[model samples]
Target: MSNITRPWWKDAVVYQIYPASFHDSNNDGIGDIPGIIQKLDYIQSLGVEVIWVCPMYASPQIDMGYDISDYEAVHPPYGTVQDMEVLIKETHSRNMKVILDLVINHTSDQHAWFKESQSSKDNPKRDWYIWRPAKYDSEGKRGPPNNWRSFFGGSVWQWDEQTQEYYLHLFCTEQPDINWENEEARKAIYQSAMTSWLEKGVDGFRIDTVNMYSKPMDFPDAPVQDPSTPWQDASLIFCNGPNMDKYLDEMNAILSRYNAMSVGECPATPDRARVIRYVSAEAKKLNMVFQFDSVDVGQSKPSKYDTKPFNYTLADVKGAISRTQSLLDGTDAWTTSFIENHDQARSVSRFGNDSPTFRTRSGKMLSMLFASLSGTLFIYQGQEIGMINMPKDWDIAEYKDIDSQNFYADALARNPGNKAVKDFAKAGLQHLSRDHARTPMQWTAASPNAGFTGDKVKPWMRVNTSAQDGINVKDEDADATSVLNFWRSMLKVRKNHAEVLVHGTFQLVDENNEKVFSFVKTSLDGKDKALLVCNLSDEENRVPEFEGVELAEAMLLLDNPWEGRIYLID
Candidate 1:
């Protein structure tokens, strides 16, 4: 048997739940913690070891829960902290672990701390946030501390009339970047807030934008990526700044004392050396990080979402993941694998099959590639059911995601009459949009809303139009060869073959195939290896090249294709 003493994460798969979109118990059209409690069995039945719930803290909902109004209190709409305790207890009742999302780099302007800090220049908490005086131009017009722009829109600074100074906000003007250099702020962050949750028994944390805490002491303008565009300039300064690892080390020290799993949303690292420095297990910084390279499958550049659609092939997808995994191998470092999350469009639409014939097959194919790799696996809600992208024609008024809404508003304000703006929104559908994956879970094929929320109850967003005709968990559960079955079987194989599938050496096998992505996984303990191959395209694949690796004694583990053989290599 696989070592039971190892942490659940060592070889486990996790499922991410966006609380607002997960499930609703009161039929109030909003999903809350009590509703999450109702769905715990459904989550556990998937064999998931960890359930990572996004922020449920007190928030103004401007940027979802990323803008925190109160660090200690749970959002009233989600549930009270007492409800959270019950959910955590329910998660632990089974063998499953529960992880919480931590967003500590900034706080909502509505937060008591920020409210007090912005009260006056002489307030005891005035220095708790990054605030600076306005720089004067030759024309005597006041400018911000620097030319930095907010990730959401125009300027990173909002003037506080009482202080006559501009405060820094990397995201929204509402979320001012906290001064981590302040000892009291650090105390409240790591000691009072973080430990309170840990002491209450949360298993781990998935830190949002973990590298954004530290910044250059002297705030200055960042060299622009696209000089013509200001959006590109905003991300340059904050992500993975100079003092990033210092902040990480300090955070790690606090988390490590309790032996909790720490996964960071890290980006902007130049190379593998930087990745290693941030995530090395011995360094006690981070256990894992979600690299954007694999997720940027269809993008030409890292952050420019509107530029253009680059042609993407299966080999390119395989290549990106292979390179990332290879570079982080054997370094006591690892990465995260997810196809759909709150931040991106759905995987089924972007990479897999949206049609009838290809839907289940492609979902299984992608699941195999991610689960067989040497890292943690994350399954966004509705992914196993093969949920595709949202309707491309969705109007800007339909989106609730702050980033998407801000972009839409910015485009309209810049060029209201421009048809290019229309085309831009359509193309933007292909890049980043939360609507693609935030649809309600499709529980049954019979119900109107797929049995997610009640019929009269208005869901936060509409369910994918395809749920009736294409995707539903009930149908897949009954269909033996469905994507749902494939997902469960894949998890079974991963669990049963933990040594070979989890702690194994990963090698990319086929580089020339345009449509087929194949890799070999060999156990670190020198056990027999397995070939995990998938033809991501629609055409039938017949591989006769690697003939010596025949499996005479091998039985088929899971055949995703309905008509395909369980035992192949014929």
Candidate 2:
């Protein structure tokens, strides 16, 4: 619902690439920028208008590339700054825009700024990061200044022995949160990093952890949701701080100069009122925001890594989308709708059945569901080929993700010697592990490394074993009935009816139908109208007749048993 007169991003379809697992051109087992350059043709073929590559910034890989050690340079494994320049130029040549992941919430402890800040309390750059002295308890035991906890678990404050103080890190200990309250630090980030990238012809950014930049003036203890797990919900104190608008407005001042297409990761901003304030065109804060309401449908409370299982129903899915669309209907705030991303499990495995008997059919149904939505569509890497979760038999050691590894260990510590603890940990992995989506992209079944690397080289992460059996880009590309081709057709449908799907008014038609997610899109002027119907369940469903509309020959998007159809109603 942006008030901007020109919203060029509305028609854009974004494809997210996890650079490490995408393609490894050097055969070193890790995917790099050069490998991305090699796959430009393949990316362009998917009909995506924008490519949002996850962080490739220089880092120690403590949290993959999110712990940026250098803002201006690319990571060694990814490539050089010169390679990035070439990538921007090449992407532009293909008429596709490129947006890099911006991780300004924190910097690696190895970063020069953090290093200087942690050197001594009286250092010139000491104020650049959040620092505090230890608070001793009544019994004289020293502890962190506050009760805040890290999103990855444990205390948020990492003690700096040299400085005799602690630095804040909402994530890993290696990533220290920067102090946005420091005007000098803010100016330095803008001048040295953001503007520098814009000058290099980069489109915009997917700002990482956007809402956590502004911390409360008094670092307060969050309301303890569970006394046993005191750190389960510290977001109440740290997230969406008072100065978030002020900071974002400063960012918009720089972004507006280039007319950038900026989207922020705002998991902390759930309400429509707060979200609109950031994304409203008149406010000019950001073009769009990624929210967690829809994705958090079946997500367990307290923490996503909690022992509880995901049991979201079909009605929950319908309600999530319907409520979101209703809130943003007439406003300038827009929805950045998506099913899967780097930090999420594969949508096919989560929402739809990934079993061999229903995999392809459910994939097509999901694709249809995504295409019918009235917002920008984002497709994650390997999503087009119906890539699923890791093999069921794979052991925990095979998982390389830091977040997953940490959670498993923490769960075990909580329930010592209990067999149910392992079961609980395994269940979380099966349902919500971020590593599920980080597996190496499957290119071809014939290659030893799934054509993601050289024949003799083992991939940095294991490839989906099913890639060798049939689920691969090469096979799907050749087969007309494959998931890849179905995605192509769905994209084509969205493009052909852009007026309805992209810019029209969304209305849920069959709200009470528990087995079907059905909605109608009407042109702004009401001349054009299209109704989308999808069978959310496995059983065959008959379309319920409408009162005023005549049902002509329906454009069957997906065949019987997996019912999906579009009709032009007069």
Candidate 3:
């Protein structure tokens, strides 16, 4: 028998909450900490063990709170510091853990550190952020230091005339990348941001872009991805940099002292071995990291905005899942099972059918497929009720996400007066915009705001019209066979068979089946086994035959016709 003890997070189910759109208590048009406190009971009813709330930190909202201006303070629109404390206490009182989004890769340009750093070249805080002198062209015109493109759009460097220098920003210009290479800055981050929250009784964190802390010391130009644009994709050069593991080790050391769990958002890292090093128990870094293979299925190289038509098949989806499922095999590392989050579009729309005819069935199928996977499970807000992408009729002006807006603007500027280019860009936004995930959560069919806020007040984002078609929580909660109810049942099933479902070893059974995703899970002790067969298409699919396994002896444990069928093997 093994003496190793499993962490609480290993078998846990995490429900991700995008605070801005989750629920609004004060009818203030925005969701807040107090609103979350009021919904704790509802969240607990989902059988989730943890709540990973997106950043509610003090910010200018340039990147929707990813650009933190004050590490210790709460965003006034979200709530006061006192409200955050109550939220933590209330969550703990329910015997559930709460993890906040940790976005330390960059800080709002308005951050006191960055403000001081930008004041003058000789400022004591000048080294807190990455700053470089402007490069001169042949004609002596000053430009950014490198040709690296920002994740949102244009150049990664933003010029500040006050200091006559350009500051690095991997994302939007308003968010400046921190100099993690600076020891003093790192120490300050550990003490002021992470340690402060842990001491405040917060459980853990869902670290954003955790692998992006370090960068090459000498700035280098990225290879051009598009001949039309001057800037190039820099993700390959910046992500998982030289000091990434070293910085993670330091962060992990602090988290260890508090016995806290960490799930890092690691993008542009496709190497399974590299991800293992980040999450391996022996490495003492992150507990698990969110991989992007499944989400980046049809996206064009370098940019999600430059997407291909939705031509990806079930095999593509299964292949991504198989790779992620096997990532930690024979190792102490763990993985996170998720298909939807704050940054990604709804899973029902992206992976499963979300039309009026098949939404509920497909949603339940996806729920069962992910809930029974061999790792920690995560369900995004509104996903349990089969929420989908934004309405196709919504105008481009209705899209509020900076990433989507910037891409659309840039696309238009590149091909002015080209109707085809404009239409293509609009289609891409409709399919993949982050705003689709940011829409207000649908609680009921009430007009104006779908009960997310008072009908008299407008929500920060438009509520999906699907709420009127029996997709809201209130309608689904009452329907015994609704997707919401199925999720509840599926979660119970996962908990009841935790050993075989959560900690089991996974093996892909029907490797080449285009429409069927069939897999087997065997417990570590080799005593219990379960077979899960899912039909990834709208049409019915026959379960594949397994060698030496008798279908006659298999007992059906759970079944959803769309289909997610699990059988206990004798």
Candidate 4:
């Protein structure tokens, strides 16, 4: 027998819930802890073993709860701390674990720590956050400390009139970067925020932008990517920083005490070996990390708001998947399998055709693609019913995400009086904005709000019109061949063949195929084997022949017109 010891998370399927859009129990136009509590039975029916709720902590909602002002308290809009405790208990009663979104990389400008840090240069909490003196130009004009651009837009450094100094904010100005280099600050974060939650019965955390905790102390200017713009993308300098490993080790030590699982949001780091280090079992840093190579395939630039789409092909996607499949072949490192999340646009709209004729077929095909991969599976809420992107005719005002709003404002300012530039930016946002994923969940066709809330009350975000066209859970759950049902069947197949589907060796077949993705998985003991062949396009494609496998003798396990075939070796 193999000597491998698998962690509980390895076999668990995670369901991510964006609380603001999941389900509103109080008819208050927002989804709260009680809302989630009401839907525990529905989630349990999906066969998911863990629930990863997005940030519902006390926040100003500048970044939609990412700008946390208080870690111990729940946002009043979401519910009370007592309500959260009941949620944890309810989820556990269903034999499911709970993992909250940990946004320790930064805190809201209104956070008490940031308020104290900005009070004065010599305050006791001044060192808790990064603050530097302003840089002066040749003309004596004061400017930000560095030329690094924020992920949301504008300069990464925001000038503080109170302290007469500039502070770093990798995201929006309201979210200030924490000083992980400070020993006292790190301990305080561990004890007050992390330890307190784990003690309250949370299983673990889904660390938001975990790789951005550390930064270069000297704060050097980023290399210019576009000379036309004043600021430059500083992802290279901010991600995988000098002290990333050390900080993760310190954080992981706390998690080990409770045997908690950690899946960090690690973006922009493409080096396979470097990515592996974050999840290496021997390092004991993180249990797994979410990588972005596969999702970044179609973007022309690092900025998701770029006006032009890249010349990416199906082969580019295949290459990314192939690389990730074999990334930790001989090591004990682990990775995550996901396509849809709160930060990304819907996968069916991006990867497959989302048109009227092919939406359901293509949605099932994409589900098969990810469920067959070897990693901890993560299914975002509403993805089960095949939600598509926002309507093409939506006005810019309908987009509520801060990132989308900032990009539109900057694009208009740069190209004044140019309607063509404005139209192009708007189209890009339609195809790539995070708001597409932030739309309220579609529960039924009974109302415009999709039954997420009462018919009289408006939801926090508009529900997609497609919900009225049989794309909601109530309709799909009743249809045996619906996309929602296909997901249930596919996940069951993965669980039934865990030996080959989860821990088996992955080998790509016909890597050059433009329309088909084929791979084989063999059990570790070499006793069982399976082959997965998927037709990524709408048209029919022939599967390429493998050198030694006999197709005639294989037993067909699962088959669908859009979804490819899975065969077991006899």
Measured by lDDT, the strongest candidate is 3
User: 466 in model 3: Cα distance from truth in Å?
Assistant: 0.4
**TM, every model:** 0.94, 0.96, 0.98, 0.98
Write model 4 residue lDDT over 1-570, tens digit each, in one string: 345677999878999999999999999999888999999999988888999999989999999999999899999988999999999999999999999999999999999999999999999999999999988999999998889999988898998888899999999999999999999989988987799999999999999999998898998999998898899989989899999999999999999999899999988887889988999999899999988878777774546867554347888888888777775588888877898999888988888888888889888888888888888999999888899999999889999999888888888999998999899888888888899999989999987899899999977888889899888999999999898998899888888887788777788888888889898888878898889888878788986797787888888777876657888775
Tens digits of per-residue lDDT for model 1, 1-570: 455475557776889998988888888777889988998888888889989999999999888899999878998988999999999999999888888999988999999888889989888898889989999999999878777767676778888888899898888888999998787888888875689899889988999888888787687687766675644464556777777777788877778777789888876654778778777767778888887777777664323455555457777788778766764466777666676777877776777766776776767777777777777888998887778776666665667777777766766677888998867755775455766777778777655677778888788887767777758877888888777877888888777777767776777766788867777777766655767667777788864244466655555676665322223222
lDDT of each: 0.76, 0.84, 0.89, 0.88
**Cα deviation in Å at residue 191, candidate 2?**
2.1
TM-score, cand. 1 vs. native: 0.94
Q: What is the C-alpha RMSD of each candidate to the true structure, in Å?
A: 2.6, 2.2, 1.5, 1.5
Q: Candidate 4 lDDT (Cα, whole model)?
A: 0.88
Compared with the true structure, the alpha-carbon lDDT of candidate 3 equals: 0.89
lDDT winner between 2 and 3, please give it: 3
Give the per-residue Cα lDDT of candidate 4 at 230: 91
lDDT of 1 at 35: 88
Better of 1 and 3 by TM-score: 3
